[model samples]
Target chain A: MSAVGGGFGRCDAPRATARLEALTPFDRAGRRATESHASSRQLAGRTATITQDTSANPGDLFYLDLHTHSTDGSDDAGATVEGYLRWITGRRRFGYRIDGFVLTEHRRFDADRDYTALAEQYGVTVLRGIEVETDVGHVLVYGVAPGFYRDFDVTNVSLPYEDVFRAAREHGGIAVGAHAGRPRIGLAEHVDRRSVSVEGVGIVEALNGGSSDEENSHALHFAEEHGLKAVGGSDSHFVSGIARCLTAFPEPVHSVEALVEALLSHEYRPVAVEETHDDEEIRERSRRLQAVRSTAEAVHHEGGEVEYDHSVIGVEVEIGSAEITHEQIAAYCESTGDTNPLYRDEAAAEAGPFGGLVAPPGLLSALVQGRGPDPKVQYGNTTFMSGQRMEYVAPVRPGDTITGYASVKEVYEKTGRSGRMVFVVNRTRYANQRGEDVSANESSMVHRQVAPRKES
Target chain B: MSDAITQRYFEDVWPGDEYIEEHQPTGDDVAEYLHINQMGRRAQTGNLDGRFTDVAGAARQGLARPIVPGAMSMALITRLVTDWMGPLGHLRSIEVSFRRPVQHDDRLRANALVTDASDEDGEPTATLDVFFENERGERPVQGTAVVVLPRRTQPAPVVE
Candidate 1:
């Protein structure tokens, strides 16, 4: 018991379980004291009045979801309590270890059906509760006894809101506004209509899975304006929404007595469980992205061309594109470790054989980059540039806009010493803006599916 | 006799010598390299195509997010040592450990530090420690290499 004590930390805990456990509906004998029991209202309510505690003990994390619906006792319900339990703890759910839920049937409560066996079978707890539809809105009743049901006909819709809360109070039970902002039945809509004081409505379900965020916020704000405890519930009629919204107690609330104690506490907060990730990972990714973008821009400006596509073998695509200039020619020469005075010095070039600093042969790569069609093949994304057959048609000079286009000329499969491979023949033609063919490049790309290497 | 291959000999090389150079991976270069490997198919490679090509796909998978392949890191590590060795040297053995993922658009710099030198089988060998670090101070790749160099007396080993 100590291991599960003082959980969600901000909410109150059971100071004396000995006194509270006596009021628990499920007893050691697996029997409920629902028949004609005396109102332990003073003993229960007073002992459970909340204390102004801000920090809840870690062990007090009451993992129980306080609101759920079932077809077991309601004709309008879609899901069974048993099925809901399976899903709440199922594999697809990424189960957060939800302990139990209160089976709140609409306008109904069945004391004869002891869910003790079912709860044990599913390894979860199911407390008996009711969602009574009053003239104002729906209200959830916890700590409901068979005696209270016998005393009042709960099926009556016109049951005065004030009188119901008073009767619930007299019998040592709680009635919270369910889905506090859900239009007609919501507590917020009937706020000014109810003749009861704020004390009559002790709590409002501030977070309901079915309600919009705006509605939940309105309910929360309403609770703040009026001194009432704001709790949360899934208001779920089926699976999936079970623990999305929960009333996080300061301590584990495994039974009706513990729940009552925590509900009356000053600090049980409505919490929404959501996914969170590390900020460091996000920041590191951002840094890498910036670096890549800048480098790519610089690489493009440096006259290096890039292939735009490589999906289909026969499809024509742009492999590279570059505008040739004297500066670009010089930079290309410098990169290749070429020290030809004919290409570097303009005055010396005019006095030389070719005249006017004719661009070198290697300068063809930079002058006519790619802005033409490049083809892709159907091998694995791993291809080997096996061979290149290029023929120089004419000398490319400075200030020529060279565009290169490539297409699959031929493709054949062969089994060789390197294993089976698809040989893709690609033909690339470089043309200047003047429509003169600059160079013709025929290459073979080996298409092979090489498996990713295992990290050794 | 100007460059190291034509001028410098193995006897002139020394341990504790270090050199560093910057590497920048652009989207275009990565795209081109990856495209060159595409086995011309009607369909496409699954995760690698988008993950290594587009920013959106890369961002989805945290490791592939940099769109940099582990093989690329290994290649850089090899180049780091090779670029320093020149034509007068022959690489004998290389070993490396990939520390993290590299991505396209990373500011990478490779550092080669000559760690040891010795005569193995009458050959003058220099062992170098190589590592690449990105701008965020993450060492994505690190390795060591042993290369046999041509001495004033002994001939350099031939490359296979």
Candidate 2:
């Protein structure tokens, strides 16, 4: 139910508006349910009528970042598809214009993963491309087809540039040289020093976000002399660097096929994110986004310093255990007023299911109270339990010994209305005497700095 | 544990289907929960001094009135799910976040909404958004639950 392939270009006016109006409530609810696990395909089916207004002038340019990487499809990338969408949503909320971004993950294209639902949720157009290495350097490919995959080994570090370029065009795709001015990996350097001639190459990346100023200048000049059109890409492996450099198209582009047509037909130009976005907001938000990367990294806030002991993460330790006895089961039932005969009267329970007495599932909460390694999160002076998650695999029967193993699952910081807060998640796994997992739980604790109260 | 309650099948549910149950926990209910949990003896309690059960104890922790114990709230939620799932349905996991306090004697509405249903990996399961709401329209406790329910086409697992 998204505008992925339909929103771009001028369509029937009155009909599109009517369909959009009918789909508005569903789309809004979908967005509000942030944790809704509705798959992209389901969302696409649900919001098929969601579309951008045709009220805009057809002459208006649509801006898109042509190159980016995400952790889902690239090993070297640190940003997730959702993370990029969140950061982009943050920028768009401030009235900045960033139409969309292309996830040109290095060496692979996940054709099965559809991001149409995410795009509709974030109100940002999401598309996919691939960045591949060749004999001349790295190439950015868009609108890839099944034939393109059969023609080239994208993982190869020395793919023939001419054939890759020819095959890309033959398969209804377009290829552009990536980071064209960098040494060893740039087509500009190879062309200048080794006289490497890449035929039918009409585009090269001129403003790669990761490249130096001198390198970009060299690329810009190389494109001018070669009569090749220039595009810009962030080449970002991190979420904050997304859309640092962008390409402006003279027409709407809502899909990879449309993107290819726009790039080939329109005379596009490169634009930097700083040209339109507020520089300070970018810096502050980027800082906040990057701060959540690792526990070893720290971010200062007005309330206090936020950091944690990262060493305890993933390190497991024995948190002790307890053997479930019939007496213990009876006590648990008595405490909770759960007079179910299965847990209280052992002989009568034998005539019923479970063969004998069994402890209530909630007994795991009381039994696994052993202490584990503290993350020592350094944030607010006040700390409290935020929540608890328990996964029960099997019932606890009498005489079964249950052991708990604990570890620090994760630690991170978030800024909320109350002020800056740090969350530490500790996880514990409970196993029976037979070494079968009985259950697992994660306890989340929030640490916040409470200001001193004024005397009444 | 009872034969009177019919089993709920995975196919019989859909996202947004809601289940509601209300409870008004009195002072005695709170007291029983405290004694059952042993208030402090079992674990390192941070209630200042009986804050969860006594007003004087709660006042010391800046609370005007005694609040319902977190474990009691979790137990209520678990019971809500168990009652709905029936004997054939299994409660795989439940996670709860306590946003605000539920005061003693306050009528609490426990709600469970099926958020998603899937048979991925051949194990039919349903995800639910569970919460406790006071009359003030505040969700004092909210979380998610994942459960495995019997499929009508498949025979129920035998309890030996």
Candidate 3:
């Protein structure tokens, strides 16, 4: 048995190998047609090059762009299904063999669009997928079929994020948090890593084309901390943005179903840029694509971008609750060296002022510390816990759960020795499951943009 | 009550100790699970020949008829070991591969054998190699689980 997770490499399934040997052979690159339901063409096409997994691990493998947008259904995309295939074919000239891309249209899966001819001609795979805007953030849903489009009103963006993930689970698909490191639409931005860690979302976008380097770094860190699977997606709405980020699966996956399995099994690695041609070309293309998007609005549905403005104040919402474990409390006390007998000993706590094994002050702050209800303030890329004040209302005894609710009580600008800092003042109320207010905290987060590497 | 397992402790378990358990999943149970979980989202619902699961839909897609959803089988297998672990047993990890399908009304048996006993993060943990098999003895699910068990002689501090 594996000690924990990770360190499991792919093996050449001997049965699969024997079956492949029984089929007719095709010329390398699958240019020549062979017998066996055109099956040999697929297996022989890439199986010989399995060791070239993006992570450079010798294993059964394939590569594909996990995120792409199309004008057929999305208002923000520049390309048709065929337009993308043509572009993918063009990339082959640059010696980048892109196997395929999942067309993540905003709010809809465009189940009717047929790309068989285009896919075959360009030797690329084009699968339909949905990019949903949930209450928390945007998630990418793959393997959405025709019935799903009609039944779920796939065009609707009002579905709650948790519902979207549950639906994806039911349907045998996964709802991966898209561009999780970015602001507003990203999962890591609004929801704390602790919440996202326990939730059904098992995958996150560690590398995204539109997000900055630091934003992607935040996503990578979040994924590592939570042991969540990290994928790199282009999030492309245009030609140049395609394949900006890719996932290399250990085994050659022929369809989107296989891709989903690879993601869930943690059998893939994120790959960014096989070859760096130029950024100016991509930026120019993005500008041109925006123009195309503007024109294509007539043919497609619009509106799916979440931007947080720090303009609102006194906005209260629920920050949800986390179930605490005995071990977690121990870890916290270990870090802070809180030896308060009243906090640890039940006998002492019973004698103390109206308390039975009350939680220490650090636990309350830790419960309230992570990002509260998103103040939607985007002052900088890095979020730092600047300061906090805790007022102990009651005690959270053992066997009690803590639920947190927060409001953006204040938002103000400050300029100290360290440049202009945006302080988002939040008031969080922590309550035990027993309807007792445990602690109330007012905290400030200093959001300051990190200096660029060259500038520093 | 027929398969009631004796409560076990960290010190009581030895490698290669085997246990067997069984569960029968019906179509109605699946319907309730789907409906209660609100899992009837577009991806996994529809054509209920009595709340037919994704396994039922798989037949139309050229797969076996009325095969059980992988998650459903996983839930069953997880319960098999968890029931034995009692309240103090904290399930750490369950890693399984779906080698085949388990259809509705297929009474399945979970076979578990203790693989190792060691300390993880200062806690006593046991690893078990678990497998689920049908009446035909064909294994559909097989994996390993790591669980932290409470010490029988000593008590842990209350820190909840």
Best by TM-score: 2
Model 1, span A1-456: residue lDDT tens:
011222111123322211223322322111121111111110110000011222333234665667787668753234567656655443112213466788887677877878888889877878877887665567888885566687676765445567667777677787888876554456665564433355688898876755544456566666777877888777654343466566666567778866776787786776543210012221122111111111000000011122334455566676655666787656544333334454567775564434455555444433343323334444444654444434456556677777777777766543221223456677778777887877766655565444342222
Give lDDT per model, in order: 0.53, 0.65, 0.54
Per-chain TM-score of chain A in candidate 2 equals 0.50
- Name every residue pair that clashes in candidate 3: A60-A250, A60-A251, A61-A250, A171-B43, A171-B44, B48-B52
lDDT of 2 by residue, A1-456 (tens): 121211111121111111112212211101101111111111110000001232333236677989998879864354678767765654454334688999998778878999999999988999999988776777999997898998876766557889988888999999999877655467777677667785689899977766545556667778877988888887765554577677778777899999899889747777565433433332222210011111111222353245778889999887877877776666555554454455666675565335666677777766656668888876666665667788888777888888889899988654322335577888989999999988888877778664433222
lDDT winner, 1 or 2: 2
What residue pairs clash in candidate 2, if any at all?
A1-A44, A1-A47, A1-A48, A380-A448, A380-A449
Per-residue CA lDDT of model 3 for A330-386, tens digit only, reads 544433323344455567566444346555444544443333456676556554444
> Every model's Cα RMSD, please?
28.4, 16.7, 23.6
Better of 1 and 3 by TM-score: 3
TM for every model, in the order presented, reads: 0.36, 0.50, 0.37
Ranking by TM-score, best first?
2, 3, 1
User: For each candidate, what is chain B's TM-score?
Assistant: 0.80, 0.88, 0.80
Q: Compute the lDDT for candidate 2.
A: 0.65
The candidate scoring highest on lDDT is 2
Docking class of 2: incorrect
